[model samples]
Target chain A: MSARHHPADAVLADYAAGTLRPGFDIVVAAHVESCERCRRHVRLFEKAAGAMMSDLPPAEMSADALPLMLARLERNPPAASADAPIAPPRDTRSLIERLPVKRRRWLAPGVWVQPIDVPQLPGDKLYFLRVAAGIRGLHHGHSGPEFTAVVSGALRDGKTTYRAGDFIECDTEVVHRPKVLAQDGGCLCIAASEGSLKGQGFLGELIRTIAGV
Target chain B: MTPEPSIETSEPARELAPEDLIVAIAVRADRDAFARLFQLFAPRLKSYLIGLGTTPPAAEELAQEAMLSVWRKAAFFNRSRAGASTWIFTIARNLRIDAARKERSALAYAVDLSEEPDAPEQPDAIVSGAERDLKVREALKSLTPDQVTVVRMSFFQEKPHSEIAADLGIPLGTVKSRVRLAMARLRERLEELL
Candidate 1:
């Protein structure tokens, strides 16, 4: 899709300052993933943020913080913790699985999710997924700018394959098929649709309806 | 640990377009580069956050979190569209919006998702008669106190409307009109600055 600019200045300024609500932040992030102009402005903000972070009083770890952490490590034992006795590592799960899930706003069998590491946001839809590989999900349009970063595994759009930790931004102008490329682990992704998703046609609408999303 | 002065003070600190390169070094687990990134952004981020109605501690938390994200996700940096700082800046911006939105009502004044951007219609650069940053500053100074408050508060709010109400303890409708008036005045002020 053709790229869109970043959110307007007031919003951009707030975003740069790190004062926006987490939900709104998610929407802008998803949009930033796709829009370069917004990214450029955001870069300026990040530079400013870095400079500011340096100015803050040094962040000291809690007194005895290291020992407390170490004591926990010793009690659990590194070997035992590695063994995954209590919470079995869904080897099928990605590292994102270990993090807290964003509250799922839209959930279904084919898709459900919980936010992870995101602060808070609004008008942004967070989706979790259990995709069957090779399923050709409908090609879709971004109603506005959208950002999707991979919390785990990956999904493919046309020629690009988004792996775990990858950041993908799509604007309302994009039209592409997002197909899952089965990783060693099943793919798990965190997607924030900034505004809304414009289903390509009846087919896309059909998929959304079936999933009740 | 900070490197010795002999260690080159991180990422060469020279290249005119070191943005992507800065991101690359940061991705390599280089704390010094990360420090440079922090030096580049945190203040503006803080100013922006303060605009949102967040307490100082909350704003600082956003800064730390955004920076940590740079540390963890620097490797994902892509240069085709923007520089490293911009990419990270956008992340911080998005996170800030998220932080303010949790307990608030839906983002009423936020971007209308249904609307699509005109296919990259290049905004004619607002002519900065002075230097680029200077023009922004000049425009800021030109605004009335009310306008400035609106702009500053704009920087703070997730939705922008209610924060004005809460900040000023006025009604929501009053906040909306004032914001509109301030924005209109700002656009005019910017024209002179440009």
Candidate 2:
């Protein structure tokens, strides 16, 4: 974990401040589970947010607020139904293991993509990318911000290699081909993007057109 | 006339910190304790969600759901890690994400926002406690209005730097720097409490 890259301070601040989109938040959550340092930083940001919240002027509430809450308590069984259950203790597995829905399909040989249903994001933009070892991805540039968190194994984009728990954010300025390292079992990643990826070269364009990432 | 907020003069439940009340609910599933917490935070949560552009009805419903989560997940609260306001706010924030996503897709929102502690290693409990100090409040006040404006925009408006720039008619870089500077100052001042 020490050698893995972490999310930038700005991104972590956005996550703690509740400003990040849901799709991006998922990527950050996956990374936080693996990086203790980022987790500590996030806690501090939460504390700061709390202080800010305390200082805001209190807003008036309806007369029924407390009564409604009490009613809910009365109606709910001591242990309620399965709706919105509390999270089980922390699972060390990748973020995909925790996903409650499965609507995945294959994009290519040794490459599978699962487009998560995040309502607040562009359709088909946020998905999981699983690539077998020894496979190489297309050379691509993003139309907007793209965040990818490695759940397991390692992948190399140009000279930088991202390992499990590492987070990589690329924007329009970045254009590279990512290849899964053969030494690792393979790579599973939760990836999110603000817009569609724009691929370079014929093979890259073909993959991008078919995958629609 | 609207009801006054000071009606609890004789109520013994007024002085306890939110952390204590949360722990109470967590350990015993105390309804009264949960009621007090709801009374204190629900309204604030409602206003917060509304301020972030959620419609009034939706915001109210969101607030209710957030409080319900507080009751259901109280067992996970760790006072050594977060204050009551901080913990509650985190719950609200997570709910907002779920709420936003649920509105967009047919898929049910099932991911746990607070499934794990923010940090693997224990954070300094002092920072959570110190955030409430008068000095920290004064430090917040010490920021230039522009800095404060950007901070508020970032945290409350949920507007990105580019959007904030467009809204304020300033350059995006200026907006980014303002937010960065404000956070640095706030973190520096708050850290001194330790």
Candidate 3:
């Protein structure tokens, strides 16, 4: 989408090593909410990390450390959260659910051009367009590396059509004109833009503010 | 290992041994359980900060701060979502933001250890506090170089794009792309392992 793209390798390593931040992790979580490409990437990294952990020699903790940790067990201690099935918040789920999960190139109604959901986010910038059917999306505009995915349906931007599971990246040099192409009612889309929209006209701004874009 | 003696009826000590118990005590607001939690997490917090590139003093202080949060916010831990190591990592990861915010220039906290020549860098010692953390370096090495850098950048500073740009000397957009790609890749990798 941009002059460059996020390397799949780096994300795998970071998540594997548990070095990523929560906010950033949330962004990635949002993307995983819609996109499978990024999901696959995360899965791969997890595997690699597990292998590494399995291979490394165990660190010898102080004798007291284990006892200390155990001694506290008799009391009611804090319970930590697991990383399994980390579901989206109710607001996000409700918004995404109303729209179809798997559409054939559907676009939200608005001025936004790219029609895709499932953004691999938390990088620098991410964009999401929550438009309804028959709504003219944002006019042709370019921003930083913009990755779009459909949380619901599909869309057609010029020749390159996008589907529910597809991932789209439109970088600084690329501007898109996206239109919804779903037959079963409509779709919901979630996109991540590297930077704010560029070259958006007055109409774009007006619509964006109106739609809370 | 002589599994820790069952709870002493006198003290509602339900914490310790398989970390689940630790959580149980933590839920009860047991101070001793909290101390145990502190003992377990304090060192990892320190190393994670070090990995992000904090000074020893700063890392120690930050680690202590994170432990205190565990003590205070123990109720928030959802064991069903993560186990001990991973959940603690999440806590430290969340707190890392606060640490980075303290210094405007901190991009995330990638401690090269070697970068700070004057500081006695104990790359292994710092990380060894948590056995799982000790494995992180190797796991990271298993990823592609591009993925590695972006993920590392995420940990180095609290500031999202701007600081990442400065620290890596790349454009803001590039950093974002890298993170997107990295998360996807990591998610995929972890899934395979599971």
TM-scores of the candidates, chain A only: 0.51, 0.82, 0.53
TM for every model, in the order presented, reads 0.38, 0.79, 0.51
CAPRI docking class of candidate 2: acceptable
Per-candidate iRMSD: 10.0, 4.3, 11.1
Residue B51 C-alpha lDDT in model 3: 55
Deviating ranges (above 4 Å) for candidate 2:
A77-93, A100-112, A117-120, A132-136, A182-186, B1-11, B23-36, B71-76, B103-145, B180-194
Tens-place lDDT digits, model 3, residues A1-213: 111123245543454344543323333344443443544454344333333323333333344654544453445334444333343443323333432233232233343433223222343433345555654455666555555555556677778656665545565777766777746346555554544565377766764454333
| Model 2 per-residue lDDT tens digits across residues B1-194 | 11212223433444556766776676667777788888878878877787789988888888898888788777777665566788788878877876666542112112233344443444343334334535556767777888777767777777767888999999987877787788777666655542
Of the two candidates 1 and 2, the one with more favorable TM-score, higher being better, is: 2
Per-residue lDDT tens digits of candidate 3, residues B1-194? 12332554434433344244445544455566556555655666665566567776676666655556565445555333333554455455546555554431121222211112212333432221133333445446566897776664554433556777887798978877777766555554444333
- Poorest lDDT segment (10 consecutive residues) of candidate 3 chain B: B105-114
- Give the clashing pairs for model 2: none
Per-residue lDDT over A1-213 for candidate 1, one digit per residue giving the tens place of the 0 to 100 score? 434223555445455555544444554544554455554554443333333333334433335533433343223321212123554443433223433454554433344445444443455555555554555566778775566555455577878877654556575568888887754355665555655566778866865565433
Q: DockQ: which is higher, 1 or 3?
A: 3
Ten-residue stretch with the least lDDT total in model 1 chain B:
B105-114
Native-to-model Cα distance after best TM-score fit, residue A29 in candidate 2, in Å: 1.3
Error of 3 at B191 (Å): 4.7
- Candidate 1 residue-wise lDDT at A207: 55
Q: What is candidate 2's CA lDDT for residue B14?
A: 48
lDDT of 1 by residue, B105-173 (tens): 123112321122322434543221113344455666777787777665564344556656887989977
